[model samples]
Every structure is written in structure tokens, then in C-alpha cells.
Target: MPLGDSITGSPGCWRALLWQKLQKAGVNNTHFVGTLPAQGCGFTYDGANEGHGGYLATGIVSNNQLPGWLNQTHPDIVMMHLGTNDVWNNISPDKITTAFSTLIDQMRVSKSTMRILVAQIIPMAPSNCADCGNRVIALNKAIAAWAPTKNTTSSPITVVDCWTGFSATSDTIDGVHPNNSGNTKMANSWYQPLVDNIEALS
Candidate 1:
């Protein structure tokens, strides 16, 4: 499922672009499943996702929501791009990582073999929130370090760097949220990981 915050839920959200790209590439049997129906993206896709706009990592985990979603959807793979809101809210990176770990564990509890693609959230524009951008960088580093330890004999968590080439000034609408170009970049970033893990679905 396309899972995250507003980046995955917004109308022109990257999830739609990713879905559309995958469809065009012949991965037509896949479906985006989530408790929340897809909004925005102009009806371009099935619009199913777990992206809760403005949701914080702690809130998502504290509410114990992932387990229910995992049980209901039973998705073969989960694409996660969270923590933006947490950083925006000035939450500590350690807490953010803990929440993310909890989320991953919850998903594994539901399906041990499930594949998860965790994103290094995109850069924040200086005009919007400069300090948050640095936080995003540090968070991404922490997430990268966190992924290897998460690899299991069955499920392996892969980290996709959505921030490396993402230029906030050019690719975002409001520094944090991605625009069409940014979404396209995200879609491309997810392509290989999706392809590499597509076998999990089969």
C-alpha cells in the first residue's frame, strides 16, 4: 500500500504517480489498499492508501492503527514515507525512529514475509522550514542505519532515498509537500524497489 502522510495522500500525491507508472510498466495486478480511501490525484487511480494528511508518527503508532490496516489489507508490500510531520512538529529524531520501528514491527506481526520500502523523506524548502530540512537529513541517516538491522530471513526492509536529488524550491508546492515533478521523482525512486520486491506478491 502507499503509506505515509500528506505526501502520499495529497491530490497530486506521489502515490498516484507511482501507481500510474507501475500500471504503465505492466504491473497491472497490484492494488493500493488502505482503510482510508484515496483523495486528490484527480481520480487518476484506485485512490486507496493509508496516508493520513498531517498525521504524526507517534499519533499513528500510539493509536494502534497499523495492525488493523495490515490485517484488513494484507498487502504484499508497504511503501512508507513518514516522519515529515514529526520533524515539523519538532519531535526528537529518536522518538520518530522509535515510532517508525513500532510501525515496522506491527506490520511484521501481521505478515512476517511482507516487503517494506521505507523512504528518506524529501528535503524541506528553506522558505517553508529550514531547520526541518536538516532534521530530515539526520532522520534519513538514522533511517538508513536502522534498515539493515531490520532485515530478517524472510522480510527485508529497503531504504529508498527520496531526498537525495529532491530540490525543495523546484519540486515542492510548500517546501514540505511535493509537486508533480517531485512526485514523479518519488515514483521513479520507488520503481526499482517495487520491481525487485514484486515477487513477494506472486
Candidate 2:
């Protein structure tokens, strides 16, 4: 499941690149499963994903919805790139982290062995949300620190850093969402960790 916000759903978005890359690499057994389906990168690609535009982490968790989705999809892996909206909305760091942690716990309940790849959200145009960049940095740091502690002999959580070398000015459509180049970068970010963990899917 390519899970997140608009970044995961937009046409030709990172999720599309992820599908294209996987197909090119000949990984066929895997399917992009989600409760919601969206079209991006034209009609040539699988458009299924759990990405919801303009949804916050708190919103996703509070509705008691993720567990249902997890049970329904039964995905082997979940690629999550949330927290952009949380940071934009100026939600406190602790609350954001708590919400994220809760969501992960819910996922584990549904599929204890499921692999989850969480992302350090990409950069945003500072003008779009003041101190947004700083908040992202803080949240990513928190996420990075929090991830390793969750690792175990089984069902380890991996953190994919999507911020490094990512240029918001050049990569994003409005400093909040990725443009084509940004999408390609995002795709590559998702691909490496996925390939490294391919054994888990089998």
C-alpha cells in the first residue's frame, strides 16, 4: 500500500513511479492495494492507493479507520509519507508523533508481520507555511529516533529519508507537493528500501 496524502495520489506522483519501477524490475506478484483508488501518471499504471488528500494524522487515527483498511488490504508492506499536513497545520510535535505511533500500533494488530516504511516528508516552500521546514525537520528527527526502537526480530519498521538532496523549490508544485522531478526522486527513495526488503514479501 502506497499510503499518505496527496503526494501519494497525484497523477505521475511518486506512487506511479513506484509502480513503474517495480514492473520494470519484474516484481509481478506484488499488488498495490488500498481502499481508495486514484489515477495518476495516466492510465497505464495501477491507481490503487490509500492516500487521502488534505488529511491529517490525527484525522486518520481518530476515525478508527486504519485498522479496517489494514485488515481489508492485508498488504505485506505499507509505504507511508504522512505528517506534511500535520506540520502545515502546526500541530504539536508530541501530538503528531503520538498519532503516528498509534497508527502503527493499529497496523501491527491487524498484521503483526507487516513491514512499514515511514518517510521523512519532503521539503516545503517556506512561504507556504512559515516554520514548516523547521517543523518537518523536528518531526523527521523524532520519527528517525522513534523507528529503531520499534525494530524487533520480527516486523521491523524502516525509515526512508525523503528529505535529503530534495529541493522544494525545484521539486514541488507549490512547495507542498512534488512536481515531476520531485516525484522521480520520491520514487527512487521508495524503491531502494523496498528492494532491500524484498525477501519479506516472499
Candidate 3:
């Protein structure tokens, strides 16, 4: 499951790129599972994802949305890139990470040995949110620290860094959503970790 907000959906082309990469790498048995169908990505691929637009991590946890998705998909691995909307709403890093923990708990409940990949989200510079950049940095840092505590021998949580080399201004179409360049970068960031997880499953 490619789980996240608009950055992961709302025409998230990175999913397409990642899928293509997986195909090219001979990962034939894997399926990208989600409730939401793929948006227009200009090519054919497994576009199933749970990238809800304008959603918050806190909201997902409070409303208990993840369990249903997990029940529906029964995914062995989940690649999550959420919390950008939460940052935009001025939610603190601590709260966001807490929500993350709750979500992870939900995932474990669905499957004890779920291999999870959490993202250090890409940078954002939306005109409406001045503090979004700093908040993203803080949240990513918190995620880096928090993921280790959640790591287990059965269900491991690997944090993928999508922020290090990405540029908000140049990569995003509107300072929030990724442009083609950003999509490619995001896809590259997710590729290896995801491949490793798939290999482990095999």
C-alpha cells in the first residue's frame, strides 16, 4: 500500500515510476494495494494507493480509518508518506509522530509481521504555509528518532528519506505537490527499500 496524502496521490506520478522500476527489476508477483484507484500518471501501472488529499495523520488515527484499509487490502508491506497536511495545519511534530505510532499499531494489529516503510517527507514551500518547511524538517527528525523505537524483529519499520536532496521550489508544481522531477526523485527514494522488503517477503 502506497499510503499518504496528495503527495502520494492527487496525481502522484511517483507511484507509476516506482511500479515501472519494480517491473523492470523483475518483481513480478507484487501488487500495489489500496482503495483509491490511480490518478492520471500518463502511463499504465498498478496505481492502487491510499493517498488521500487534504487528510491529517491525527484525523486518520482518531477516526480509525487505517484498519478498514488494512482489512480490505491485507497488504504484507506498506509504504507510508503521510503527515504533510498535518504540518500544513500547524500540527506539532510530537502529535504527528504519535499519530504515526497509532497508525503503526493499527497496521500490526492487521498483520503482526507487516513490513513498513515510513518516509521522511519531502520538503514543502506552499505559499499559504510559511512555517511548513521548518515543520517538515522537525517532523522528519522526529520520525527518524521515533521509528527505531517501533522497530521489531517481526515487523520492521524502515524510514525512507525523501527530503534530503529534494527541492520544494523546483520539484513541486505548486510548492507542495511534486512535479515530474520531484516524482522521479521520490520514486528513486522508495525503490530500493521497497525492493528489499519485497525480497525479504519472497
User: Highest TM-score among the candidates is held by which one?
Assistant: 3
User: Which ranges of candidate 1 are over 4 A from the true structure?
Assistant: 126-128
Better of 1 and 3 by lDDT: 3
lDDT comparing candidate 3 with the true structure: 0.95
Number of backbone-clashing residue pairs for each candidate, in the order shown: 3, 3, 0
State residue 50's C-alpha deviation in candidate 3, in Å.
Answer: 0.5
lDDT of 1 by residue, 83-119 (tens): 9899888888789889988988998888888789998
The residue-by-residue lDDT of candidate 3 on 52-146, one tens digit each, is 99989999999999999999999999999999999999999999999999999999999999999999999999999888999999999999999
**Ranking according to TM-score, highest score first:** 3, 2, 1
TM-score for every candidate vs. truth?
0.93, 0.94, 0.99
Q: After superposition, how far is residue 74 of candidate 1 from its true place, in Å?
A: 1.5
TM-score of 2: 0.94
Q: How displaced is residue 57 in candidate 3, in Å?
A: 0.5
Better of 2 and 3 by TM-score: 3
TM-score, cand. 1 vs. native: 0.93
Which pairs clash (backbone N, Cα, C closer than 3 Å) in model 2?
A: 11-40, 11-41, 12-41
Model 3: colliding residue pairs: none
